[model samples]
Target chain A: MLERSHIQSTGFRNVGPVGERTGFELRLRQANYRGTRLSLIEGVTITVDGVLYPAAHNLVRIGSRVYTPAELDAATETRLAVGEYMTVIVPRPGGLAPGVHWVESAIGYRHPYFPPAHQSAVARDARHATIVMA
Target chain B: MTGFRYGVSLYSYTDDLGTVMTLDDAFDHVADTGATGLEILGETSVPLYPEPPAAWLDHWFAQLERYQLEPTNFACWVDTRIQLDRKLTVAEGAEQIALDLRLAHRLGFKFIRPKFGVIDYNLTPDPIWEGAVERNLDLAQALGIIILPEIHAPTPIHHPVTEGYIAFIERTGTRNFGLMLDTGIFQDRPLTAWGGGDIEAIRKDAPDMVNGIKVPVEHLDDIIRYVPFIQAKFHHVDEDLHDHQIPWERIVPRLKALGYAGYLSSEYEGVRDPWVAIEQVRRQHALIRRLEAEWEAQHA
Candidate 1:
């Protein structure tokens, strides 16, 4: 008999009845602007389950329907017309967490709250000075 | 005996008082907050540099009276880097202490809260420490004011420095020396947030590090017997207010039961909006007033 390890595959979104009567909040971030890094995801059209979620304050939203950009299968159309919005229907199979899990930017890397630890530059300078003195 | 009047320390509103508040504005603000007194910072609030003129002193007292707020204290610090060594020499520390006393006397402050250098500075409480205390008390007594050494963070009540502080006062046998116990020593943050500043950093390296800092709320019973002034410190939360991380529900009652008539200042540190923060101080003030009334109702 071989011992087996149970592996749980959890995805980007978690969809279920909100616990404690409070719905979970999720952020829809635009990571790809065709290699052009810019704030305000300008001229980006977004939708959640065919409902129009306008990009305002660089964020688009559907009431209680949390969706991320990764969840949207991009169409050949690169840009929406001026004052035009995109319409994409919710995938029949996709929902929230337990419904879908989208890949995120490399985790455990470059988290602003976790700054990289470095040796003191002053201490290094002091050591060099001492070496020069010697 | 008139109970020690409530006051606001300028350090309590470092954001507003440091920038927007002038001495006159501070008096007005403290009075508006219903505080009976004010504690002005030496450099920031008092005309310490180039000496405070007699006319300036007179104007300060007039402003204080106009707002009906007494000058309770002047918080004084010594720039030890200029005077160096872990502790200041008795003569050196005394010079600064005497300045605090003179300023207090001039501005009509009955008390002076002096920061006894940084926590690490007085770790072992050496002879220099004793010398500083002796000299400060002497200067304060001569000036007819009480010099209070504040028991703040990085030093617990039971720390040797605190015990040595009490011993120094008792040994000197001067009525002009005392303690200012800041309630922040008893505060508790989430274990994950202890020193990491992350509020989410769980240290697998050291299990006990989570509860690394303790402020001696249990020893508050011992320390309160000697408390002359209290930094009635209120942050956004009270959980981080003490060494044992004392919840005010327990600590406040204990202080009241002890008949602590010391000044309880409104030290609000909620970093939102000025109006909102002031409102917070008011709410806490109301809570304290109710607590004091309840205590009096029973004890009186």
Candidate 2:
């Protein structure tokens, strides 16, 4: 099982004090609990408040590899080593008079045992972050 | 000798994980019921799994020593879909399994319940599950941990997945892999007081939700050897210590007749009210103890 843990909004900074644009990074560790490595070819999805942002669309930095939307979509299958973790940075766009916000992220992919065209299932984790728009 | 050993799953008191009860409290509760074994849900019980620090591991073992509890199973997940876009390769899946195996071994557990990725809500195995299991068979043997796929409710023992698992075991001749039969399947009816929904709606849905696709009690004989433990899944226990849904009277004796020696871990997947759940577990243990004595006498 690829378990998602330690999900937190690490750093938040304001682009403008009037809240023209807000930026934050959601830091999480995706740990592979299965006896094997996994690939993130399908891309990840991050939902802030109720807005859905695909990893392919957002900038994601794992290790030293920074993936653009087009690159994440076109990247080959890179396996995540078992028991090893990939620290993921999901760049979030923010516009808020915020007291608290909820973030949910999930990666949807088919199991190797699943047949072709079968609906993929998701490994999901969520966290609540109290944000102060200072 | 009676073929069954009694135990309680810490999952029964999950409502108290970080609140009312700590892991120490859970061990005390299990010991109070005269159960020597404990089944721990790795995700909830272990704080930072696969890499918990030495201090945490020491505390875990200390609790076990204090309560004289044996770790029976470390229930975990095998997520093939950790990535958003692609499935893990066979080797990758094996790596995840090996990781859990190492953790389970380190924690002194002999059994690991790995929930393989499912295709349906009923937890139908993905077609490649055999390959996943096959790939890890060696590691499982080396780690000395048996991987038991939970045959939970709504998924009958006769389901194609169960059959496939049985075939896989036969084909591979591996002793490190087995089945963990959940007693939820023997539930003959739906729970009346299950976390208040529309009583009528629950009543209608309960049958299909709990017992609709159960493995018949008779089928237990055919698969008894493969089963190392039974998750005695219960929702409610009455004043008389009787479960309204599962037919324990019939099932317990059958297990004895088959000479099945395994832990019957009380897995209370009921409401989150801890005190009531504790009482319910106590009553369930009473029922199991009574049945064990009765069955032993009859056979003797």
Candidate 3:
């Protein structure tokens, strides 16, 4: 079975003052438990209050490389090794209210064993605290 | 009839990681279920690997004593080729295994379930696994810990790797090495929670792929003696306390007949919500208890 474990979101806070574009950082570790190197077609998606944010955004940073949606989606080969961790960072800008908000992130990929079928791994962080003016 | 004991692995509560239940909460849940044993992932459950703070160790033992739970298996990672660029040397791999063994010993766990670096989706052990494990046999014996490579799903019980492991044990006569049989191998049907609606439809849709791998129930008799621990791997348990996927009815009785007394640690890998998963674990323990009693009565 393909597995991803130890997924978490860290360094989440209000990026700017109350009336400005607000966002938080998402950090997650993705490992390929499926023996062979599996291609990670699209990195991940962050959902905030029912809104979907793809990992292809220009603000998304996976390791040292930053990519826009088109660039991340267009890149042909991104294979993850059996035990290697691919730390991901997603920067979302805009419309984050004060107090608590629900945040969820998911990664979708294809493995060779199950050809033509996509597998998705998801992690959610509830009680993400935000300050009105910090 | 074998006196089988029920336990809960912290991995069962994976869905609630750092959100709903902390490690302490998992202990309370296991204790509440009257499970006498507990298993934990070394990297995830332990605060620090190779070395935990004195205070954390104190609190850990206190919880174990307070809840009266025995430590069973310390799940560890044997990463030999996880590196994206290069593979670690045999020494490096052996070192990782030894470190975990020492940690397991210090934590009072006699068994360790190590996930070796696999070479295929079928979980064939990496070629270096044999050498690495061979190097650490002495350390394992000295530490009084048994290293059990998990024979999990999609990897058949009769696979070459499994045969090789059994051969290694026979050749070396090392009691420190054995297998941890995951119940996923006995899954009879595709999990409805994972595969929507019709199991056949899902199988048909994914023609070349398998939903669950099934090993003949009777075949377990051949290997049960080599297995000291069993991962009661379940994807879903219905409201009626029946697991529709795995053939627990047949498998449990087979183990009982073999007099296979080992820890059946609940490992719920369902797609259900966290709270539901917790309840499913409790249900699994109840089912195990019921089956054990039934087996005892029939045999007597």
Candidate 4:
């Protein structure tokens, strides 16, 4: 079962190696009431400790596949169903000093059903998550 | 006199379904309200959707039998704008409906509400909707189902969008198609909290959606014959049994006057604060049932 909030706390960690960390990743449960095709997700922006990482710089991983912002616009076969979460990979060399940090995510969604002006909806969430290991 | 049938759409439990509440918990909540019908979203409520495991299917029937609720409407999506650059063709749309029709039959649902994607802000469905639905008339009839596209708010009962639907029913003379009334259209007051989506942006771009379109209740008399089900969409009902948004007082009388004996499925789009919908749904049932009782007393 996923958490109630859009931003999940369990999947918060740094990737690559101990000394030469490549980046950090966090999970986000789909915020919409219904699951959307991957193409419908415009982008997901990540911000940590006030440092910003725009949606373009973040790569989303759903299941075993990773997708860029442009790829997400064309990937129609993939779906993040209700109660499912995807990990947002933000590239930041040497990650963060192993500790608790304030993290936020802004996910842009293009729902064709919504009116033209309101089609691009952004779901934002912020919370404190701990990176246990360096 | 025949009174209205009461039910609840699983949509009322939007945020809490997967978090704090389970499917069993939802059944308990609705049955406790004395509602005899249960409405569910095909994609949202059905695990694995189009193809749930046999075990889940067994569990679904078991839940229905135990809760003493009958399946009402199977809510679905046409997704006309399937991708950013492309839209689904009429054939694809027909296939979508056919798939849901079969699934709804398996789940013992009488109605399927396919929310077709819109062409513009007026929420006019794509042109392919007609052709798509035209092809599924036989299948819907065979399965004993009615395809109901909701007459929701911001899109009033008199708009060209609704006229198009009525025209289709008149032109084809098919009993398998009808309009599902979403009571939100008759909302005469402003909504404080919208449970659907981004509220502030909706208020700025489409004020009619948030501020209410205020379609008159008398309009129900215009097309009540074409309507067989109503989604009781409401935002808030206070501790004192007062609905702050939708005006059921005017609407209920019109429905009763029309001799409509269909389900009033609670479609709660309100504050997503966990269990607030449970009590709000109960309040709506109480308030609407009281109005029905009052109408019966007057006539009898």
Query: How well is each residue in B185-289 modelled by candidate 1, as lDDT tens digits?
Result: 665552422311222233443333344345645677887877878877655533222322325666667777676787887565444233344555555665666
The segments of candidate 2 whose C-alpha lies over 4 angstroms from its true place after superposition are A1-134, B192-207
- On the 0 to 100 scale, the lDDT of residue B20 in model 2 is 59
- Candidates 2 and 3 compared by DockQ, better number: 3
| TM accuracy, model 1 | 0.59
TM-score, ranked from best to worst: 4, 3, 2, 1
Per-residue alpha-carbon lDDT of candidate 2 for residues B1-300, written as tens digits (9 for 90 to 100): 845788898778754555456667778889999998988867667765557789999998998899988899998766655545555577776776778788889999989988776666556765556777788889889888899988876678888778878888999999999999988878777665553222444344344554435457989988888998889988887899787778888888888888888899998766655467688899998988799789899778
Q: What is the alpha-carbon lDDT for the whole of candidate 1?
A: 0.49
Compose the digit string of candidate 4's lDDT tens values, residues B1-300.
888999999999998887788888999999999999999998887877788789999999999999999999999988777767889899999999999999999999999999888878889888889999999999999999999988987799899999999999999999999999999998888878989876887778888988899999988889999999999999999988889989988888888999989999999999998899999999999999999999888999
lDDT by residue for model 3 (B1-300), tens: 349888988778764645456678888899999888999888776654556789999999999999999999999866544333345578877887888898999888989987776666566776777888889899999988899998876677888878888999999999999999988888878665542122353455542223577788888877887999998988777777788788788888888888888899998877635466678898888887888888888889
Query: Where does candidate 3 stray beyond 4 Å?
Result: A1-134, B194-210
TM-score comparison, 2 vs 3, better candidate? 3
Which parts of model 1 have CA positions greater than 4 angstroms off? A1-134, B1-4, B48-50, B53-55, B83-88, B119-127, B190-216, B237-246, B270-276
Ranking 3 against 4 by TM-score, winner: 4
| lDDT of each residue in A18-86, candidate 2, tens digit only | 544544555544422222223433556777788787766555555577666456545533443332334
Best by DockQ: 4
Worst 10 residues of 4 chain A by lDDT: A110-119
Which whole-number lDDT from 0 to 100 does residue B208 have in model 4?
Answer: 91
DockQ for candidate 4, C-alpha atoms:
0.66
- Interface-residue RMSD per candidate? 24.4, 9.9, 10.5, 1.5
Better of 1 and 2 by lDDT: 2
Give the Cα RMSD of candidate 4: 1.3
Greater DockQ among 1 and 4 belongs to 4
When only the first chain is scored, the TM-scores of the models are: 0.23, 0.60, 0.55, 0.97
Instruction: Point out the worst 10-residue segment of candidate 3 chain B by lDDT.
Output: B194-203
